[model samples]
Target: MFHQITVAFMLLIVRALAHDSPGGQVVLTSDETTTQESTLHVVQEELKEAEIIPTVIDDFLPKFILNVEWSSSNYASLGNLLKVKRLQSEPRITLREASDSSASLCASNMTYIVTMTDPDAPSRDNPKWSEMCHFIVTGLTLSSTSEEASSKVHFTDLQAIIPYKPPGPPPKTGKHRYVLLAFAPANGTTDPLHVSKPEDRQHWGTGKEGHGVRDWAKANGLKPVAANFFYAKNKKQ
Candidate 1:
């Protein structure tokens, strides 16, 4: 039932992460305190009705490890970095500081292809299951030490088939979930377009294999090596 609680919060965090600037993780603030509180109240009521004991957001999902660091924000762990008032600017990543989390260092040769998706479209309650992918970086390499600055052994910027595009959810409609997943492509860049830089990332079509995380992982014969997410709220709402 703990997993169910996590799922419920994930449903709440439907607006989780979109994009973080290359500079680092950034935070977005919102003033919808009443709405936010009301949403939490609803979640609590649902939990009580189900006889479920809800825990803090930290227990909702597994945190991520990048170069021996755990993924986090000023507020809490992964999936806990809530609220992006505006869907544009990249959020600053807080990987370099994971002193409190149980983080594991990675092997030098390990690499992953990261992708983030927006599940509900036009708006959260609307149709268009084909989610809008917000960020896709291929060939991200992990190094033993933070000093290693080579792009090849770093976050795999050059292998970006699609550049980072901040998610801009349609006004109103409701909140949406943005999940980030990291995978090890078994085919080793099967698509011809999986180059250093694709012509575009903003206008790419939504489908299963091309940019979908689970679809891509299924097609590539691997699961997500790492995953992280956060939610955001629209200003108009």
Candidate 2:
């Protein structure tokens, strides 16, 4: 099944990260409403056995809220309007390559890619069957042979895709905005990495726990920078 494949892929990626030369840390957390104590405990034990530190954020906290705020005037009852929601919340992408820093992705270095996805969508408020996004972050520096080539990307991998629906009597024309973010060490930075292929976004939101680029960066002592608005287009292959 698709779910199994996604979970397997996520596990493989995490395992790879644990074995990385400079071995990085991974933290998995759940929203307050969900009791993730047992799950977190298991993950911690596993990480410890593997010599990786794991952190969890289960207490209901404002900093962990993941929703968009619309204008007060435009905000109607939750049941009435089509609102934006996160399909994949917190998928982490790990890149491994032979570079000393983040500046060498373009220098003929091959990077390993890891990503996650969230498929949950809003209810009947909108007529669309599903609305989701994919995010990918690579870990090229971790795998690089050059000590100077091991810098992380300054941003997270982000891609949004919405299915098309027939307009009723009046065809409405408007735009929806999605955000792509990146996080890196304070002194570390890089120009925006451009994704020109649809396949790049397809690997997102496929993990047991949703992945967020910001969370991944923070766990790894990095800062996050987000791109405010991204427009999705309809293209035929």
**Which numbered prediction scores highest in TM-score against the true structure?**
1
Whole-structure CA lDDT of model 2: 0.29
Cα misplacement distance, residue 168 of candidate 1 (Å): 0.9
- Expressed as tens digits, the lDDT of each residue in 1-237 for candidate 1 is 875575465434433321342222322211333233323333333323322212111112222332211223232123333445443444332222122231342434445566666655455455354356566666565432253333223233336555556656666856555555555544443342242332233223533322344444454464444444445556686
RMSD of 1: 11.2
TM-score of each: 0.50, 0.22
Whole-model lDDT, model 1: 0.41
Candidate 2 lDDT over 145-177, as tens digits, reads 233233323333323222212111112323222
